[model samples]
Target: MKPSIITTLIIILFGLFTVQVNHRHLSRLRLIEVSLNKTAAGLGISRNSPTSMPKASYSSRSRQRHADPEVDIRQLANNLIEMVKMIPESESPKDRGELMNSLATLSEFSPSQIKSLLSEIHKSDGIDDELRKSVMGIVLILASDQNPRAGLDLVISSHDPNGSLMWEDAIINNALRSFANSDPAGALKWIEDNREVHPEVGQKENLEIALLGIAREQPGTAIQWLKNIDPSDRDDLAAKIAKNALSNEQRMAILEEINSSFVTSLDTTEMGKLKESVMAGLGASLDPDDFEGSTAWLENSDFSPEEISTITSGLALKNPCANTGEWISWMVSHLPDEALPNQVTKSFSTWTNNDYKTAGEWLESATDNAAKVPAISAYVSQIVFVKPQTAEKWALQLPEGPIRNSALKRIASVMESIYPGSEDAFKQRHGL
Candidate 1:
């Protein structure tokens, strides 16, 4: 299975957002620009190559600061009593343990219902520390649902310190998500005030998460806070948040506030993310439902395929910000098939001119043979300038049709100085 592009981004986020970060997950060097073209043809980057940080420890001195929302103690106490009566008993301890494990994954219960269920799971005989831990994890996740602060407190109180710290980190993540959904600003404020509290993850780390949340709902303030983050971390974070904004204008507005230049100064991986953003913008512009709809989109977009193709081709050749092969795949995958050939062919011309080996190798190994024609033709035409025989070698292997005819014609055109009637002869032979 392909490793996720988003997972690479997420790991970077996790370190700036939580304690108990996974070292293996951190150590993996994930490529930010995934080769979405990966197929049985070995289209994408090699799977083995991919591409963290210190985390806060549980501080015994940390204290719970958020006030729990009002709850009916009597109702919780009553549910707990009734829950105790329903606890299952079995002669086979394994059977009983299986039942407890399922209870840990329960998803639909209310806050009180979950509380009662947790209490019952605790008293069940034959359940081990590991199984008990799973139940505790569920409690932490569900705690954020209703009365998040209280739910979190209960989670904290129930969590055994000797057990996995990963669970506590998961709980913090869940609670933060919940807080962000209801009151992003408040959530940000809460993290600022309480993140330094003992047992809580570091304030700076959690601030990234809170800022992300607020950024989605209120970009104006969100960008200000997000920019204040360490300069090195801001670019990708800006791109990630901007991608989720409600509209193109909003996405652009958010990114416009970014301190670093995504186009100019960022590393290759971050630049790859920028390339994806531009590609996505181009994709979104392709969203008309019919032939006329495409015309309508053209009226609305920056320019038509020719213009975008030129821009992308120039960027690919100049900065080399993204993978050229993947760019070809992206064009084929997202743009209309008939519409893409000429546009991408333009890119192949530039790519062949700039770095013949990589471009030629990709064209050779690429298995989307149908999509390869225009590019092959373009490369052959360009190669004819320096090596007409080499161009003929390439053109001869093309399937017996227009692409072959086109490539042959390009070779024929180049041979005109040496053989005056060569073009006519080629046209006649190929029935062109």
Candidate 2:
């Protein structure tokens, strides 16, 4: 009786243990399947088959999952080396050239890989023009990357005594365009140093572009270059070169000199063209007040329709709201009847309503009686339309008189229009 009971208990315990082990095994297998599905989705590969799992060594799998920087760098370097070696020495110039270009594309990797390939090309004496251009392309890419100085050094060292004309052109143009904006002085220096070896390297046009870039960073040096050009030549190209070299103040001085010296004797038509050129040059630099003054001067001066148009165009470049109320008044008074006060009011109303604070500041600074009326009206309209709460603040700032009364009336009118029978409600709400 005791043996039978013990055997039954043993069988029951073994069955329970097997059930628990099977459950644990099934849970672990499900987790693995979920992880594999996630990895497949991330890689944009189908997970419908068991073959979706990449076959690789354990170490390779670990490296792929958590990249080892040193191993990645070594593999990248090896790939670049293999690409370079594929360029056959005895192959057609075109084929060898294409392979070199492929090598240059590898410059997106480490600079060290680029340097190694370039050094090998330098050592090999028989490379053709196409291959040379590809090398320079790589150098340009490297110059645009972190180790620009190293790229520059490689370019300087690669000067061929018997290099083809196409090779020289390609190298110079690529290097100039890439490094010119990055470090203009360094670029100009390199060109200057190589001008003797490559006699036609730095032409007037090339030098001008380089100087313009340098002027953006160092104006004094650019001014010195301008001073070196002959006066007759300078007169011919002064507007073009000075357009790049001079600061805003210097440009104004140049315009004044041109006007005093040449504007008086010229015919109306020619003088008009010249004024247009000068105005365009000062388009971004002239202050809004200065534009108003210039416009006044043009109306008084013997400027033709063309000259007037030029001055007006320059004025238009400035934000209309930046013009003082006095200036706007003058414009309304002086402009043709077609450009009426209502038109100005409409434009200013739109601008003020758009929360253009600059325009608002200009409207506030306006002191002219004719200009102030429309400007204040437009501002009041803005408050009614977009910012009712701000209207009271504006009204309170007006001096006690017609202006204050007019503004208050406009605010009341707007409130009545928006909240009928609620003027008192608005007044109380705003503490008017």
Candidate 3:
């Protein structure tokens, strides 16, 4: 099977020809890409020359631009131009998204470079509207950060024959929101200072975004910011920061700020709705592990009666255990008719589900106690689901009284539901 020398020489020549052809194709692409810089400038596009990047193209045609270490700005500057020239709508959005994502990942390109690249693509002739939309959509994702100068520059300078806007309100809002998250203090100050400069900026959105960001890192500062916003402008924004109150300390801080405001009217239903909304948000923000800490803080705080009622009830519903015996005692004496409906019963019910031994012991000892009926009634409702027999045992132990009768009434009903016709027998056993 030995080949002749002539045959081997022929194979070598063919291999060399293939390499030369491939190299020529790539060189042609580079030339076309680089020449766009000249054509773009003549058409009034300002080409940004960021720090010179080493001359390179993605070594692999399909490799991710970010993950591929060899990718450089000089290579990407023209690559972006060529990518947009691909026949409009010829590629799926997913494919277009990858290209757009790669462009955004080019952090090596200054904001100016990104803006220039986008402008060239938009102004480039022969691209279909569908393809232009795809490019515009991708550019929006890239422009999601705070680069107002570069973005505004492109918009103002664009000679887009189609009258398209790449720097619309959504884009600016995104930039402002992003800037606020990154630099809340500076961003808010900028908004206040630059009102005349960027009058169209959504000041409300910007302040709300900045306040929410500040709430996480500087809650006390956020409270002051909340106070400073025009009262007419303080709609649902407070609820946003209020929801960040994961700790009792943060929630109480928010309440203190609210109390200092002029809306401390307990006599009006409108005021109640506003206060209730804020307290409800704070309650939902509470961490399950903060149950003990919340109770300890509630003891010393000077919350008004209505505020305390709504706020504590909010906490009790999320985690019934937060309504410890002292809380139930306060509710019974001060809010007898409203105590159970306010969901104090839910606290005892939840505690029993978690630690029945402790809850059962607590209930057994509280029999015949004045403030015990609510707790006992709450317990009977919870136990009837899994352990109707256990509920019957607890009910039988109750001495003759309203609470005992309430317990018997609940237990007998649950037992009959569990075992048909057992209610009378259960009542007889408990001497009902």
Candidate 4:
């Protein structure tokens, strides 16, 4: 694929940003900017031909346009190397993006010339390790977009002498994503076909990246494709699909489509988990400023009590600092009693784990008897393992009722297991 418009924008923006960084680097940045302005400037820098240039193909259109030009691939390679090295050790992505944009200059070179340029950079001595890796990463992305097989080959060839591929994670992610975006089936086929030779290509994380790219670019077929993978892999990738849906508006569309697919393809248990994941994603997506509108939407929707509870718990999990009392009060008003206790327990467990001091203080000062009973019960249930003695004290504070009895029973079970022969004494001491 050609250098993205975003890469172009990064180059422009980087020059603008770097102009403000230091005067010493100003001349160098400006020179790079000027070379960018001249599309032919990259190739025109030197007349000496590179030795041992790899054989490759450029489109006939490009070949016909720049046939027999005076160009040095080494000069182009050095220019890219210099630009990357110019980026400060602590420089941000902007500088790196500028380096990427420079790769676009390769469009002016023949495939052989581009290969020669990369080869020169690869073989060049004394190049900074980061500069070489960054340059290779950009090439990998561009090559993947054009041909995933070629991208994979480039990746394998780019490995260090020690057999470790530099920037493996980032390279795999971008390459697989590029492959999937352009040709999902081809990408999957490549991975499956080459799995024996390159087992890492078929690993879960790499597969997830490829599948997610397809989910975004071609959501229509993602479910069917996912179903064909290993059962364990499918479930994990499916959950990720649901959880990632609410990240943005476009992905939300994918979420809806994928939800429909899940209903059709997945079994009841799997579908239920998928729904919870989606609700959790939705819960995380909630903005405090838009809570009322979001709640209104939820209330009008046809979600079950369990799903609604999951969403609220998700919201609480996302922001533990949210007022626990108000959250409990809202759930009490909305959720049926059957779901209330479990949801309260789940939410308070999460809150207590995050900030027990604040959570315990709120429970102590709580005025709403309706919220406190279940809240205290849940708190004790969660803290029992980590703080058994404290759990006993909290359990005793529960009001006299089934909730209190249940909390004490839970504490007894946990404490007895922790300290053998202490169960009867504890029950007797608490008058249970």
Q: Pick by lDDT: which candidate is best?
A: 4
In model 2, what is the error at residue 205, expressed in angstroms? 5.2
Instruction: Report the lDDT tens digits of candidate 4 across residue range 1-432.
Output: 223232332343233323333232233233233323342233232212221111222234333344245687777677777765565442445555555445533434444554566688888877756546546655554444444456576676566655444445555655666566667677777777767777777888777766666666554455456655776676567656544443345334545665766677778897777666656655665653455565676677776777777777556665565565566767877776777877777778788888887888888777764567778877887788889888889887877878777788788889889898888988887778
Q: Global lDDT for candidate 1?
A: 0.51
How high a TM-score does candidate 4 get? 0.51
lDDT of 2 by residue, 1-432 (tens): 122211221222122222222342223223223333343354443433222111111222122232233444434444444434443323233433343333323434355545555556555554445444444444443333434445545555555566642223434454464566778777777667766766555655445556667766554455445444433433323344344533454554555555665555556775555555655544434455565555555566564444444444444444554444445555665545444445456546655755557666776666655455566666776766656657767776666777666677668767788779867765565445
Backbone clash count for every predicted candidate, in the order shown: 7, 1, 1, 1
User: What lDDT score is found at residue 228 in candidate 2?
Assistant: 41
Ranking by lDDT: 4, 3, 1, 2
| Two-way TM-score contest, 1 vs 4, winner | 4
Model 2, TM vs. native? 0.37
Winner by TM-score: 3
Q: Which of 3 and 4 is ahead in lDDT? A: 4
Query: What is every candidate's alpha-carbon RMSD to the true fold?
Result: 16.6, 21.0, 14.9, 13.2
Query: Estimated TM-score per prediction?
Result: 0.40, 0.37, 0.54, 0.51
Global lDDT scores for all candidate models: 0.51, 0.49, 0.54, 0.60
lDDT at residue 203 of model 2 (Cα atoms): 51
Residue runs of model 2 more than 4 Å from their true location after superposition: 1-119, 123-129, 147-153, 161-186, 217-220, 227-247, 253-280, 283-432
C-alpha positional error of residue 311 in candidate 4 after TM-score superposition, expressed in Å: 3.5
- The residue-by-residue lDDT of candidate 3 on 229-332, one tens digit each, is 66555636776678787666788777777666636533466556556767766756765455456655655676555655666565566544533555566555
Off by over 4 Å in 1: 1-132, 153-162, 197-212, 228-233, 259-432
